[model samples]
Target: MATSPTPALPLPADRPLLGIAFMLAAGLLFTLLDTGVKWLTQSYSPVQIVWARYTGHMLVLGAYLLMLGWPRCRAIMTSVESLPGQFLRGLLLLGASTFAFLAFRELPLLQVYVINFSTPLLVTLLAIPLLKERVTLARGLAVATGFVGVIIAIGPVDWRAQPAALLPFGMAFCFSLYQLATRRFGRNDHPLASLFYAGLAGALASSIIVPFFWSPIAMGDIPLFLVVGTLGAASQLGLIMAMRCAPASLVSPFLYLQIVWATISGYLVFGDVPLIETYLGAVLIVGAGIYLATRRG
Candidate 1:
C-alpha cells in the first residue's frame, strides 16, 4: 500500500503586528465616538445616545450583510453556536456603554479614559476563573501596579461631591467582563455574526427605554448621531478583528493609546486640562498593562 502523504500542520493563528494596528485604529475611532457621545450628552439622555449607537451598529451591519447576498447573510444570521453567551456579551457591553456615557456627562474626557484603563487589570484577574487560565507572579504584580495607578488617577475625590466619579470603575468592570465573554464565545463564531449579536442586546434594551428619554433630534445633529453609531460599529468590528488576529494580551496594550487621543481631544474641543495626577496615574496604569500583556505565563 502507498504511504499517505504527511498531513500539513496548521499555521499559527496570531498576527501580532496586524492586531496592534487594528487596535490602534480602534482606539482612535473609540475616542471619536466618546467625544461625540459627550457632546450629545448635552442634548440627549444616555439611553437615547446608546440607542443611536446600537441602532446605527445594526443598520451598518445589516447593510454589509445584504451586500454579501442572501445566502451569506442567512448563514451569518444562523451561525449562533452560543446564543446565551452572545446575549450576555451584549448586555455586559451595554452596561459598559451606559456607565461610560454617564461618566462622560459628569467627568472630563481624559479622566474617564484613565479610570477605564483599569480594564486590563480586571480582565487579567477575571480570566483566571472565567477562562481557566494560569497567572504567573509577574502578572499578579502587574495587576497590583495597575490598581495603584487607578487610585492615583482617582486622587482625593470627595465621594459625596463627585458621585459620578465612581461611574468609570463600573464601566471598566462591565467592559472587562465583556472582553472575557468575547474571548470565550467569539473564537468559533463568524466575525460578522459576532458583530451583529454584540450590538443586538444593547439595541433592544435601549429601544425599550429610549422612547421615554427621547428628545427630538435636530437635523444638524443627525450627522453627529450617525457618526456616533458608525464609529461605534466600526470600532467594535476593529476590536473583533484584532482579537481574531492576535491574542488579547498582545492587543490590549494598544488600547492605552486612547488616553493620548482623549487628552488631545479634551483639550482641543472642550478646553479641558488634565491634572498632574491623571498623567502620573495613567503612566503607571499603562506601564502595568504593557507588562501584564507581554509577560505571559
Candidate 2:
C-alpha cells in the first residue's frame, strides 16, 4: 500500500496527431474567414468581397515569391505542361469562392457548412468518371449515404422559395472540379506553382468583374477587408502544411471540426442557431466522410 499514486500514462509519440492539430487550426481559421465574408457581405456585394479576398491572397503570394528570390520566383511562375490545368484549377476555385461568398450572405454559417461538407463525397464520385478510379462497394455505399445526408441537411429545396440554398452545393461541386484538376496538375507542376496560378486566376478574373459592382469602402471597414484576405491565405497555408505533414486520409478527417468553429462563431457573432435537423444531417455527412476516409481502396 506504500506505492504512491499510479504513474500517469505517457503520451504516444505520434506525428500524425501534429498534422491533425494543424488541420484543426486550419479549420478554425477557415471558419473565421467565412465569418469575415459574412460580415463584409452585409456592406459589400459578393463580387466585391471576393475581389478583396483574391487581392489579398494574390498580394501574399506575390510577397512569398519575392522572398524566394528571382530564380525561384521565376521557376514557380514559369508555365509548363500543367499550365492549362493550373489555369482551369484557378478558375474553378474562383467560381467556388464566389458561390461560397454568395451562400454565406444568405444562409447561416452552420447551414452552409453542413451543405458544403458534401465536397469530399462529390470528389469521390467524380473520380470514377474523371480520374478513372474504381469505387469499392463500401465506398459506393458511403457516397450514397452522403447524398442522403445532403438531402437531410437541405431539408427540401424549393427552387423559387430557397434558391440561395443551392449556392453551397454549387460551391461544393466547383471545389470538387478544382480538386480533380489538381490531381492532374499535381503530377506535373510544383505545388506552390499551382497555388500561385490559383491566386492569379482569381485576382485577375475578379479584378475585371469587381469594378462593375464596386462601392467605395468606408475607412472603418478597410481593416475587415484586410482581415478577409489575410485570414483566407493563412488558412490555405495551414491546410497545405497539414497535408504535407501527413497523408491526406489522415489529415482530411480533421476538417470536419470546421463546422464546430462555424457553429460557435455563428452563435456568438450573429446570434444564429441551427435547427436540430441540421445537426442530424451534419452527423450523417461526417459519419459517411469518416467511412470513406478510413476505407481501404
Candidate 2 achieves a global lDDT of 0.79
lDDT (10s digit) by residue, model 2, range 161-215: 8899889988888888877777677445555676678888889999999989999
Q: Which stretches of candidate 1 lie over 4 Å from their true place?
A: 1-17
lDDT of 1 by residue, 70-151 (tens): 9988988788789988888789889999999999988999999887877878988989998898888888889999899889
lDDT (CA) for every model shown? Answer: 0.83, 0.79
**Model 2, which residues run further than 4 Å from truth?**
1-15, 79-81
* Candidate 2 residue pairs that clash: none
The global Cα lDDT (0 to 1) of model 1 is 0.83
Task: Pick the lDDT winner.
Answer: 1
